[model samples]
Target: MSHPPGLDLGQLRSHLDRERPGLVGGPLSGRLIEGGRSNLTYEISDGTSKWVVRRPPLGHVLATAHDMKREHRVIAGLHPTAVPVPEPLLLCEDEKVLGAPFYVMEFVEGTPYRTAAELAPLGAERTRAAVLGLVDTLVDLHAVDPAEVGLGDFGRPEGFLDRQLRRWGKQLDASRNRELAGIDALQSALGRSLPASPAPTIVHGDYRLDNVLIRQDETDGVDRIQAILDWEMSTLGDPLTDLGLLVMYSARLELPDSPISTTASAAGHPAPAELVERYAARSGRDVSAVSWYTAFAWFKLAVILEGIHYRYTLGQTVGAGFDRIGELVPVFIEHGLTTLKDPKNSQNSQNSQNSSEG
Candidate 1:
């Protein structure tokens, strides 16, 4: 069997037999799912049954951030709920099996549309419907009671917004390369204007249209969001933070030849106002403080992209776009400042954008 990078098929098969015997019917083959800049993911198969494996990136020494166990726990907790999540199968904490901790789940069939080009073939009407579906699904996700789903203790809700600002600040400092203008001002502004958060709920730290998988329904339209993938940052917190990120991504970003971007720049996508109104009407959540959240989203994404760029500078990253990722960080910082400075839709900073109960 051909082996994908960062995985040993023989060791994986042996571990599966010891942990989940009879799970595999034949030899296992695997392929790396590209485009993930954080945790590494793979599609593994036994020729009869297919599964997905998620693990930390190679040389990722921080176990807490890219923890497979945490991701598995969150997914399993939401399995019985209304949330559309891939069923968790097995979690391997032992690093000896795959050179890192990893988890397996049933392979879900759907499209995680990442770029405007990818969504173009679906046409304007379908693209518009698909993006709106993302917001509806988010409302559904935020509606779940953390305590009922056994996720009440997932994170610290009190002072969640404050801690988020400080945490991302430290993350930025860790990856500080060149002098980024307005970044300090944006951070200070966010710290000084922290708004009161709503009641706590499960927050999808990285909610976005591209992060979700969509499929066509019986009407032959993209109305169904099959699964909301990437739960590594799942936690309990103020839910509107999720909305802020959506707003940030919804902005029309014109980065000439920029490699890093979001699908919100696509045509036929709903305006930021429409998305917020939909959430407010359906979820009944107060989105007044959402502007602050969107600003924070810009800062958070800036830090993340900078980290990737930093790694690339050190020759530590592999991929086609890493070379150009650094160029996008300053752009994010600029947007962060702009969003926070806006009085009409100010939301404070937090990487995890949650929509709390209104």
Candidate 2:
């Protein structure tokens, strides 16, 4: 199982042939998808059906962090649940197959909106409905009983929040170059503002607009969420963290600066606040505490993006996105600071208390 300098197309096709046998009709066609920072994703087709293959990045990665087995198990467990996840097909732990561990799944075809502008063509009514649909999906995901879904063992239930904060904090420290005063300040603020945990729910680790897939059948009129992609970070944890991460990542560009613009409706996307209200109404979960979640989301995103920054500095990245991501760290830090300034908002205050006790 020698790791190739990059993806081996010939070997991949041979493996597919051996694995699926008569299912594939012809020789596979490979098209590499851009923008995945931590994994290699390939779109493969046999002239009839399309499938996706995901494997680890070319170099070193955290042990157990990108386990294809865990990802396959999680998606497979959630198949019968309401969460719209891709149908996983095969998982190969034998490193000899593709140089590193990889898994294959049904190729889902749909537009993944990276910004609000892309969501705009849906018009105000459909846009609002679509946002609500996203919330509904999250609610449905959280509502499923882990035991029934066979995901009760996703991760340790106790101390999930504390461990998350500590984990991200460590990640930030390890990836920081030097003299990042704001990074230090953000770490302190996050540590001090820790919220009590909510009843543990399935956390999507990276719940945001871009991670979702939408089916826009005009006849059906955008009725179903096609799939929720990238389950590498899925776990059992504080669900509010997922909500917070969404708000943080999709923060409106007017009052607060977010990496992905919420006003992207010109491009066709819903605003962040609208998305939040939709989620609150659908989930029946208190939305008042959303601010804290937003702040925490910023902290977590900053940490994650900084890891990309570290890689870019090491000359490991091949795309343009990672080149500028390091510059966004301060924007997230500022958002975190703004959130803490008004932490006493009645809605979020109650949530904080509830979470601390949970």
Candidate 3:
């Protein structure tokens, strides 16, 4: 049997049998799971048991972007919390086993709901509940005390907003291959109008509907988030950044045959404002500065998408839908600019007022 690229069943079974002992009952069979644009994820089965494996993608990897240890650590820390995260099983840092550092976790059963069509079957009410649940779950995640969870040192939270802007700017520079209009302007605008971050908590760097597993409970027929996946970008940072990223994804991208997967167009999908209001009410954090954060989210995603597009050009990526990633970067940059300049942006207007008063 041909194992998926970046994974060897023989070495995996040997390592598991040695370290975990008796975890592997029968032969291992695995296949790569789709929809992940950064890390390479595979679903592995040992005839009786199933699990998921995660590792960095092949070639031209950005520094500190795909750390298996970091992802495993965050999930392990958040597993005990009310935050829905997959249970981490084993972490193998020894590259001899998988040819790269990798981690294993219990296979979570649920739908990621990438497109509106995927969510349409649940009806409007069910979709609304699921989306609201997304916000509530986020509140639950931000509510966790990082020190209590032993994640106090997960990331440097001091000056997080500025550092985040600089970090993403550097990432953008690293992936630069061609002229991207408005990207630099967006970066500069975000730096100029940085918002005051609340006390730092564990931030799910990429919190969106598609990054979580949603399963409808058979007994109650209520869609529930089973486990949150893809923690590669998680860290101890401004919690509002997560909310910002969520809000960015909540906005509809009007594009025909868009490469980016989004459920914002789904029937009954709550407005971004509703999600923000719910989060503010539940988390008790002032969201008045959310517009700036949302604009920053757009800029960050544009950089990330450009990085992916760069990787695709280098033939380093290992998935479909990458061919069109370049097309979305400009749109995201435009949104970032528009978000900051919009008269409805209370954050920007407030900042301007404060500056003038001072």
Candidate 4:
């Protein structure tokens, strides 16, 4: 059987046999999982045993993005926690095995709702329960003490917000091709008003509805988040960054046929403010600076989309929907700028002042 690009089934089977003998029960067949624009994820099976694999994109990979080892590390660390993550089976750093570093984990059976239409079938009540579960899982993740989980050295949290702004700024610069109006303004404004981060925790850098796998509980017939996938950006930092990214996605894109994924427009999906309030009440972290973090999430996503667009231009990206990714960058930049300057976020200025002083 023909496997997807960036993965050689024969080599993979050979490696699995060597590392975990008898792990492969039959011939291995695989296909690339769609809807992932950053890393290439594959679902492989040996006729009986199934597994999921993750690797970097085809080409033009950014420097600090798509670290398979780091992804595996965080998942392994969190597997035992209340936060749901796939059980990491093995991590392979030998580049020759797959031409790039990759890892394998147990295949999680669930649906990653990518659009409003996909979520509409669950009915408003079920959808509401599932989305609220996303918030609760996030709180559970942030509640874990990183040191106790052996992830204390996972990231540098002291200057996290500043570093994140600078990191994504550099990422945007790296993907620069066309002139992105207001991107510079957005980046500069984020730098000018960094919020004081609360006590650091393990953050799912790209937390959203689609990034998680939701399975219906047979006992209750209620949809529940089975596993939180896509940990390529997981790190130790401001946990609110995760909430901000979640909130940004919770708002409707409003663009026709936008390539960005969101379930916010779905029936019973929680509002951005409601998600923020739930997180604050559960995590007990001051969310007063959420606007700044939300703006930063917008900036971060714009850079990410631009990077995907850049790779698409170079014929390095895999899968459909990439041709339209370039159109979303400008919209994200505008959102970031507007979120920063929104009068409702005037409290963010005081938060920034307090953070800078602290």
Candidate 1 vs candidate 3: which has greater lDDT? 3
Candidate with top lDDT is 3
lDDT of 2 by residue, 1-358 (tens): 3323456667777776788787688766777786564677788777888888888877646748788888888899987777889899888888886778898999887767675557656665665556567777888898878878888878886988678878888888788784554767777777776667767777888776667877777786764578988888889887878877775654443433334344333322344565577777777777676777777777787787788788789996665456677777777777777776764441233333322322
- lDDT of model 3 at residue 241? 93
lDDT of 4 by residue, 158-218 (tens): 9999888888888888989999999998888888888888999998888888889999989
lDDT of 2 at 128: 52
Question: What ranges in model 3 sit over 4 Å off?
Answer: 59-63, 177-179, 310-323, 343-358
* TM-scores, all models, native as reference: 0.92, 0.85, 0.91, 0.89
lDDT of 2: 0.71
Superposed on all Cα atoms, model 1 deviates from the true structure by an RMSD in Å of: 5.0
Whole-model lDDT values for every prediction: 0.84, 0.71, 0.87, 0.86
Best prediction by TM-score: 1
Stretches of candidate 1 off by over 4 Å are 218-220, 343-358
Q: Write the per-residue lDDT of candidate 3 for residues 1-358, one digit (tens) a residue.
A: 7889888999998988888998889999999998895899999998889999999987635638889999999888889989899999999999788878899999999999889889888877888899899999999999999988789899999999999899899999999999999899989888888888899999988899998899989999999999988888888999999998888887878788897888877778877777788899999999888888999999999998999999999997766689999999999999889888882652233333322322
What is every candidate's alpha-carbon RMSD to the true fold? 5.0, 6.0, 5.8, 5.9
Q: Model 4, which residues run further than 4 Å from truth?
A: 59-64, 177-179, 309-323, 343-358
